[model samples]
Target: MPTESFDERFTGPTLNQDLWVDHYLPQWSEPARSRARYDFTTDGLRLRIDADQMPWRDADGSFRVSNLQTGTFSGAVGTTRGTHRHRLDGLLVETPQVTRRLWTPSSGELEVVVSASADPTCMLAIWLVGFEESGPEDSGELCVTELFGDRIGPLSSTVRVGIKAHHDPRLTDDVRDIELPIDATKPHAYGVRWSGDGVDFTVDGQVIMSSPQQLAYEQQLMIDLFEFPATEQREPRNYPKTAMVHSVAGTSAS
Candidate 1:
């Protein structure tokens, strides 16, 4: 297979309008809230989770998150299409689903050069979520890389990679945490290649994770950095929680 070159960088002192949208949920109207802000930088896109910021849309004054998607699918979080609960033999079963018209590549490679957050309370994720409103079988997630600052050790950190079956029958939802040679807080390239049969994940072009099942339907790219505030179950820290993205590039067989 040949490489299909696709590059998206944070240029011109701002995010490129043609390549991205601000969010995944439609309820987040204008004058948004939270501490997740996206802007351009000399290195790339700067996604910061400011704990001191206030809420923008919903009154849920909790942690701030910046969720951007390659496609605008459903309006609400997940699928609130209808009250999918009914009584069958005096038992209520709820089916939450929605359909999304998203852009997905059948066989391609996507790479992100990112500097993970250093804040112990913040986290970063690079993954592909299915536009699963089509059916329950369409619900699957391809998590190429996910890391929390607290997981980092003095030498290396564990990078979480895998596939979640969700409601999909085609996947086993197998995932693993692989130790790398460098610090995750520094910039590194995380990539994934899907070729109908399976998926292979790479770090700096070196394979680290793989899956045999395939999801050939519509999907979208979701990369974000966010922080969760302290609660009764969790503690707070002073780590500068933020994600610095240097670039996002893709390739496919041509």
Candidate 2:
């Protein structure tokens, strides 16, 4: 087994503020709007998106999200510099973030014990994204696991795992979706063992996918629960949609 650097069980009366920031891309959306709606219970961290919750970034679209990140850093406000800038048009920072790096490992084995909500409009994802402190080209992502509720079945689900190049030119997108015999609404361990050689994606201690592309930059963990807007076929309801995280553990490469 790899030597563990940290293990967070969420056995808390409150969240460990020193290790996590309960917001999703606050630099682009502002803290009040990006703040996550979550709580800790015997089941661990329960991230939820209520029916009445406002969209994360109104300019982006009508989607709401609750998330936690191990680190955050960005340039001055109004500057187009921040982690995970998805649009090519550029994203101005709404608020400058004080650099925080609770855990940023260059190469590691990171895992999360998690379960997704059954609502088709919701999605649960755990990923490691570049801190982008070294350079904008470092903003790649290693998607540990991504499960959309619509892809989930009673006894099987389509799990997405791989690398996202984003702004990182050295990397190419290699994401893939594989059908697995498992109930996504139930607890499962999703993980990734990454190094300069490549990355291996795993589920329930078993390797599900492997890639030859290398991502050697420092990366931070990001856990998110998203709720898409109501479509013509699916209307919004008052029921709360939630994703539960039983634990998160990581072992840095020696």
Candidate 3:
């Protein structure tokens, strides 16, 4: 195991303010269509998405669901701190004018024991993103774990991992939907090790997907337990599906 860098076990009654920033946010800008549906319990960090919950309208005039990240970002529409652009490369990238704070990690291994929501309209994801002050080509992402609802089967579910190019020439927009041995809705440890030229993903210590591309830039951790209503159809199998995170631990050799 790599030497300990940063670890959060969610043992307290609330989230550690020093390690996390609530929402994607500055509340003045990207307000939710509704309110946060989370509980930081001794059992873990519980995140929920309710179909009946209405989204809160933002100043941008869009209603959004609950969202949060381990890092902080805020700025204007086109303002940048360093070299990153104010907009995306036609897809999703950082929004600079509204972004301010970012905490990038050194080389490390990040592991989280989590249970996903059963709703197909939602997904539970843990990933890494470039601070992107370096520019858009450097705005690649390492999706350590993305558990989508539609991908879940009766016995098991497929989790996608690896790099999402996002206009980065150095990355291969490659991702694999690897079938896990257990039901994703049950608590399981999903991990990613960033070593040399590869980012290996594992489930309960078993290697599932290995991406050959290792990003050398500074990256920050991001956690997403959200519902994309656009991804849903008919009535949900269940309402207010919650994603439970037992812990998020990071260790580094540096």
Candidate 4:
């Protein structure tokens, strides 16, 4: 296989007319302090934040450093079905709180958790902060490109998981609307893989979304999640959902 270069497309919240594609993370410089640990044996990640520690702001849309500290939620590891459910902690964005946590940025793995709240707009994502630098204006180099797709629903397209970059702190406006085709309602697993060429989203070890010639850096492993539309409830539906995480060992194909 031919080596793929870095891909840094932007499609979330664009600045001016920029498409705001996904950001690239060099393998050596990923954010490890933000990674979370998943109890694969239990099918969920260990949320460390307490219920009372949740922040007071709304954690929807784009998030910045200043607001990142003000948006989070918490709950105990409640019980459901015949097993223990994952107690949500930290910031809650959108409906079914789709969020990411890097247990060790230094490692090649990341945990992307999804909780399908009761709302219909499902918390498609929680928070995302990627790194990218644009070339001189008009230098014929638009480093970012928009992702294409829709929200998760009967009429929605398959959701694509990835990252983004922000040059400012205020996140009240729509940065951009880069949608991807990610089907989160099937009760299955999805993820993205990157190498020297580009980034790819996969489900059950099957590649789904491929971004060729769109790599921001080499050796960088980014993490992201997706949630479907639900009601106002913060808890996910009792449908035997699974929390899938990629091994950071870099030895196997996820």
The candidate maximizing TM-score is 2
Give candidate 2 misplaced runs (Cα > 4 Å). Answer: 1-4, 232-237
**Compared to the true structure, candidate 4 yields what TM-score?**
0.34
Q: Mark the regions of model 3 whose C-alpha exceeds 4 Å error after superposition.
A: 1-4, 25-29, 33-36, 51-64, 74-103, 230-239
lDDT, residue 60, model 3: 32
What's the TM-score of each model vs. the native?
0.78, 0.95, 0.79, 0.34
lDDT of 3 by residue, 173-212 (tens): 8888887667898888888887566788888888888877
Positional deviation of 178 in candidate 1, in angstroms? 1.2
Candidate 4 regions off by >4 Å? 1-41, 46-53, 56-118, 121-158, 162-187, 214-254
169: Cα error in model 3, Å = 1.4
Please say which candidate is ahead in TM-score: 2 or 3.
2
TM-score of 3: 0.79
The prediction achieving the highest lDDT against the true structure is 2
Which of the two candidates, 2 or 3, achieves a greater lDDT against the reference? 2
Q: How many Å off is the CA of 188 in candidate 3? A: 0.7
Superposition error at 89 for model 1 (Å): 20
Off by over 4 Å in 1: 1-5, 27-36, 52-61, 75-79, 82-103, 232-240, 252-254
- Cand. 2 TM to true fold: 0.95
